[model samples]
Target: MPPKPGVIPLGPLRLGDIFNGAFATVGRHAKQLFGVGAAVYGGALAVVAATIAIAYAATADHLDRIFALSGDEDPRSEDWVPLLVAFCAIVLVCLVAAAISTAMMYAAVPVVLQEAVLGRPTTFSAVWQRAWTRVPAVIGTVFLTWVIAMVPILLAWAGVVALVIGVVSMDGGDGVSVTLVVIGILGALATAPLAVWLWVKFSLAPSAVVFENQGPVAALRRSSLLVRGDWWRIFGISLLAGAVAGTASYLIQLPFSFIGMFSGALGSANLSDDPNPTSVIVAMSGYALAMVIGQLVSQLIVATFPPLVTGLLYVDRRIRTEDLGPVLAEAAAVPPQYTG
Candidate 1:
């Protein structure tokens, strides 16, 4: 609280104030945030790029062989194995990076912001200590939210499948596929509201898990309690923050896109210069590095905003619910109570 001026005010924040404070929080703590982010996200992205590079390196020759086959010749099963292996490796890398980065983005960023809010000195070690311990619960919260958000799509898929089955069983003729299309469209239309409702209702769960140290289920309940009667405001702020974050991320990432395009153009031009594999590898590596840089910068900005704003919203809810600002202001000066 000693450095309290730029810290969010310890009272109910309007949409305007919340956004203002959200930006302020990012600005005030950008150094620590980005430092922590670099380690967590940078490694994950490197894995992605490395996987892609490896796949390309591993399969390039096999792909060339498949393409070089004579007009009358077909590829053998062995010709497909390299492609298959590369595809599986890419998928595997993606899944692992996704799992690691989700917790780092949602759980880790909020933990850092909460420490700042509590007026504690934030170091990478301190932030990681808090967030790393809660990684499991944070990931569970993420998993639960995704499952909930995908309910509509899953339902539509099921409905489509069921409709097809019934149509086949009944020997329904030409119109069955048309009926499936209609049901799918209706299901999509109906899913929007349901997904938005669930999303807003549980949006604060990640913040609850970090700041309140609640488990996934209890964090869900905590968010529901805090979000009661303020659903619209939360939704509005979330939408606005999403727009701002998306725009900022796009702008930050725009140059990298240009770099990608330029590298690609450069690569395309160079491809005709030589039929040699070494030149091709060099060009491909350059393109891959460009993409990796773009993604890393994109992740930095993209990952910061949502959790920061959501954490502020959690603070706003607490101020309204229990007058939490004064206590948090004193957070660094006091020891935590553990009566529960």
Candidate 2:
């Protein structure tokens, strides 16, 4: 089968189609995709935790050295320099670890998702393998998207900040500042659409680069072209996906908040004179557990939606530009017992 050439319906129906496509795809390939997504998220979270631990461990020594430098201790102390150097070195290592984690997680997006679309079992090794060669392109595409998205945000932020400053520094009484605040708010509101437009335009670049092997500029161009006349629908789908992910994260965090509140109450009652270290560790342990759970669930849900939408967008583009519907239908293997 191949895609039939005709006008593809991309109105209210499109959002439903995209959501259904994601649900079906994830339902069918939940194990493989979820596994890979989980591992990446866990690995990344570990890196973050390690970084925090390292920084915290250095805090006492670093603060001491700062005091030493300020002449409270020995200014000529040789230990201070080495301690500061070590602190900087650890920070650099943490940064590199974080970079590696981000690269692995996003690069895995295409490999696993595409395998699901092709009705193949995705191996963890296969994800690494497929993503390795595409790493540079993927990184570049994402970096470019960041730059593009920042333009409007930067502009809007500048306008808002200027407005705020102007209002705060105004020579008039309270009424003048109020007037300036209102004007700034209006200016920021006016720039909101451009911010949104840039965001949606480059949103699909990673998909273009990974699945299409497009060069950085070409990927962005392709994304722009694919999004043309489709921004509203794309925006709706993206917003829906974001809403789902955000709600899930918030719900997941609620338990930790409750635990923290109870612990604070307990500490205030029992350890009012001096908070116990054991108590602190116990509270932190609960927070850490909650964080891990949230990361796992949030990553799974977030990963599911984008690749699904990207696949749909890919199919849509092929149908429009190359009449690829029938080919996609044949290529898509819907198992007889498909529960997704």
Candidate 3:
């Protein structure tokens, strides 16, 4: 393909081109993307870090109750209040942060990519202004997707329940129950692939909403239309992108992984010697910080890369099926007609 004036080529893209384009998209728009990243993921990481610190503090506070158990007191039987508080804190933080990150990042990336394709530089403010228009559609699309993806699992679970109920009502013995368990296992296995296929079927939804200016319901239909005969192509590209991105993230996180490993080892070793709460807290702190850093980097990769690939897939599908390149080019070329 000849070089185009944009971050990505105007023609249909190869896998290498898609991945390279994702990198180029970020490289060309680092300030804007990173600013968006800082706004979306940075806040979440802060919440996680604060919540984890509180959780650790809770564990440290309850350690005395755990260690002070005498012959009469069983440590297992004791209710650890602080630790329970910590677990709840962590869960709450994760739930809130996950909801925010999932909704907004999906909205933001496609908006910027659309601008990139149009041969315009986008600012963080401009991206946010445009992206906000698609958030409701993005959220609805995501919810619908989750519901669709759950169909297989839900059907499998229903089968298991029906089998158990029928067997119990008929006074069937252990052998029948064991047979039902095997059936449930096979049902789950078969449905897992179906679930993944269904996901790929609707994976281009955000792009449809953003680039094609479709509503939530319309976006779902548009995504299905675009992916109609090309499910395998999208699936293969997605898998390859995942493999490359996952490997890069793992290598980038290796140093932090090593620090976490060493910290865990030190904490475990301390259990045999002094076994003090301070040593446990110190080790746990190191491990927690390392894990947080790793998570942030992983999230940044996810925010930057996967959407770019998905956006490219969306564009490639449109170019092939609908002759989208000329339409986009024509729109970019023609000035707005004014009668006033």
Candidate that would win on TM-score: 1
What is residue 232's positional error in candidate 3, in angstroms? 1.4
Q: What lDDT would candidate 1 get against the real structure? A: 0.79
What C-alpha root-mean-square deviation, in Å, does candidate 1 show against the real structure? 3.6
Select the stronger candidate by TM-score from 1 and 2: 1
Can you write out model 1's per-residue Cα lDDT over 1-340, one digit (the tens) per residue?
A: 2235336766777777777777777777787678778888887877887898788888888878886788999888887887998999899989978887778678777876765665555666766677778889988987898798779878887888888888888888758778787888888788878888888899999999988789999998898899999999899888888888788878877787778778877876867643555566676766667777877777777788877889899988998899886776666566432211
State the displacement of the C-alpha of residue 279, model 2, in Å, after optimal TM-score superposition: 5.9
CA lDDT, every model vs. true structure: 0.79, 0.64, 0.79
In order of TM-score, best first, we have 1, 3, 2
Q: Candidates' TM-scores?
A: 0.89, 0.72, 0.83
Candidate 2 lDDT, tens digit per residue, 1-340?
Answer: 2222212232222556666656766776666567766776677677767766666566545545555454454544465665667678777866675566555556666656665555556555666677767768877877788777767656766776676677677654677667766766676677778768987887777777777788889988988888888788778777877787678767766776676566555645554354344455554565556556755676577656665576566656556666655554565554322212
Model 3 clashing residue pairs (backbone): none
- Per-residue lDDT tens digits for candidate 3, residues 39-126, read 8788887888788876776576477767766778766533476567678879988987877777778888887787666566777787
